[model samples]
Target: MSEEKNEITLKNYQVKIQDGLLQHLAEFIKPLWQPKKIAVITDDNVGPLYVDKVEAQLIEMGHRVVILTVPAGETSKSWEQVQVLIDSLAQNNFVRSDGIVALGGGVVGDLAGFVASIYMRGISLIQIPTSLLAQVDSSVGGKTAIDLNAGKNMVGSFYQPNLVLIDPSTIQTLPKRMLVEGYGEIVKCAALVGGSFWEIVQKVHQPADIILQAESLIHASIAFKASVVMRDEKENGLRKLLNFGHTLGHALELIEDGQLMHGEAVAVGMAYITAAFEKKGMTAAGTTAEITARLAQVGLPLVANQLGSAAFYRAMLHDKKIKGDQIILVYIKKIGEPAFYPLKITELKKWFEPILNSQIEDN
Candidate 1:
């Protein structure tokens, strides 16, 4: 097949999706940025794999490239790591005119994007998301964040990147588990939008099947997200829909304490919440079964059994979605239709207790 070329124009920047764009990195960067110094922030896992090639492209463009690699994983998305990167930038003299390139999965994107936002009160950022999860979800949105003791993505900013380059070939290096982890987000997106995207996602019978459809899937995902972000860049209204499973997902991720990857936690969250709401007659009948089947097809866990309802609830109390005393819960009336229900903090447990309790009992 001829290499797919798709571009999404958001409110502030552009997202270019192609199969081999990474090989022509300089061509893309040349149009949006002319910075003399560019800090390429990535994780150790990704650095060893792609940093040299990325640096070569940057160097070819006559840009001073600084490779800042941090430990790979969620733990790296912390205040101390942020400080470490800031010091590195300062020590190397990264001025306001210089740009930052986030070159890994979600953690690296979130951490480096946050640093780019605050250093010198904000600098240009370019997101070169490697992992499937990052390319499909985190990289497109421009919602950068770091985790806190309280919850995931608790500390961060709404900093848009000047450009986003997604090369699906990078996903070839991801392990099976990592690819499945990414499907959690892809499934979440499909669940929210529904229709053909949802249909396409459900057709995948195995993890490797996703690779066959990566470029098209990435394009569809980015297009849907870009449409949402263009309307509600600050997530004040329309963009809130994107938090479909994130509320409980973040809590489950926190309570699991790294045992659960972000996408897996989201899979469990989506399953539980859909089932719970369906039982209460709030969601469309059979929606839970459909979602559960899809999640199972990809080997995503449907239940987080280690923690009880109280612990999960406590973690959720710190979620960014909680507005004052009410938390907005996103659910579907049926496939292709999603609605948000705002529940008071005091009544949040009523929504999750039955499903969680049953899960505990089963375990």
Candidate 2:
């Protein structure tokens, strides 16, 4: 098949998505930034699979490249890892003119992006997101962050990248579970934007099919995210809608520790929150059933009971979305229509009783 090149222009930069983009890394990098050094931050999981090829490509173009690999998974997204990266950069003398490349999944993107944002106040960043989750969602927006002991993405910045390069071909080697986690983000994006994309998601099943059709889905998601980020780059308004299932989803992820993947938790969050939104007349009457059924069909979780409702609620109190006593929440009116609702944090437990009650029973 022919290659697909899709562009998303933001206020400060652009996201370029295409097949076979990785092979031409030098061509893409030269215009974005010409530097004495390039720090490629990736993970052990991804580094072994794809880093050598990427490193060779950069070196062939006569660019000096530094490769740094962290352990794979969420645990790597921490202050400790950030310090390790900073020390390495300092020792290697990464200056303002130099650029950092995020060459892994969301964990690497967020960690490296945060490193780019804070090192010497700020530096140019090029995101080469490999996993499906990072390609469709995290890589495009400049929402760089590292999780704290208290919450996910609690300490970070709204630092946008100089360029985002996505190659859907990288996902061919991803584990089945990781790809399903990516589908969660894809479904979340479709629910938010709703149209032909939503229709496409409803019919997709099997991993091989998703990989075959990855480019289109990822391109559509980046386009939607880029539009929102361009309008509200700092997430003051329209950007908040992107948190549709994330509020509760984040809480569950923290509580479950490593058991629940981000997408799986959010799938449960979407299902649970949609039910609550329906009960409150905030969402379409059948929104919950429709959303949950589709997610279930795709094998994402509809309930999280590993830590029970009370613990989940307690964890949510520490979420970044909680502003003092009030928490900012995104609610769905239906597919393609989402709105923000601020509620007192103390009232969250009572307001989401039905969803929480179900989790209580499951626990």
TM-score, model 1 to reference? 0.95
Q: Which number leads on TM-score?
A: 1
Best by lDDT: 1
Kindly list the per-residue Cα lDDT of model 2 for residues 69-142, writing each as its tens digit.
99998989898999999999999988888888899999999999999999999988889999999998789778
Worst 10 residues of 2 by lDDT: 354-363
Angstrom error of the Cα, residue 300, model 1: value is 0.6
Cand. 2 Cα-lDDT: 0.84
Candidate 1: pairs in clash:
none
Q: For each predicted model, how many residue pairs clash, with residues at least 3 apart or on different chains?
A: 0, 0
lDDT of every predicted structure (CA atoms): 0.86, 0.84
